[model samples]
Target: MSTYQDADAWVAMADRTRRSIVERLAHRPMAVGELAADLPVSRPAVSQHLKVLKRAGLVCDRAEGTRRVYQLEPAGLAAMRDELDRFWLRALDGFKELVEDEGDPP
Candidate 1:
């Protein structure tokens, strides 16, 4: 298990290419070759993205023969999602209060 600061998770996912790779893995585990086939980047670029995701704790890998397969590290992603949800909840509550305050005195 690894701990990722909330802000960094957002940043790691900020890039469109990285997000696309992550989203595809969210569906199922895939070998690097398969990932490259589906992506616009070359295999080496995909490898580099995997390295970033690995360090961020958002992804993990295993070896099956010569292939290295990658998948979402659910535990890390769950933590990230929880943090995002909490942020949204707080923002929404503030929005609700602001909207209410703009109306006649409560």
Candidate 2:
């Protein structure tokens, strides 16, 4: 599969359930069953969320003996973080420009 964009990760995490799953995985890796057990969604639903996350490059899975374990993908998370940092830097620069303009004679 092609590498996913940071926007894809943002879209995938826009859902409450998916965000919850991400948060859960942030703490530790888990199987779909374990995720479903703690969440209100069904196992199949959790699996579906996993699929979206996987496609977005936010999560990856590996077979662990019998069950497939899912965990956060640091590269994907870093992409999102980098995007956020860039956005904040742009906003801050714009604010600084406005402040400087306010003090200018013209």
Winner by lDDT: 2
lDDT of 2 by residue, 1-106 (tens): 2334666788899999999999999999999999999999999999999999998999999999999999999988888888889999999999999999999997
Model 1 CA deviation exceeding 4 Å by range? 1-5, 103-106
TM-score of 2: 0.91
lDDT of each: 0.85, 0.92
RMSD of each predicted structure: 2.1, 1.9
Provide the lDDT at 12 for model 2: 97
Residue 85 error for model 1, in Å?
1.0
Segments of candidate 2 deviating more than 4 angstroms: 1-4
Instruction: Give the CA lDDT, 0 to 100, for residue 65 in model 2.
Output: 96
* TM-scores for candidates 1 onward, in order: 0.86, 0.91
Q: How many backbone collisions does model 1 have?
A: 0
In angstroms, the error of model 1 at 19 is 0.7
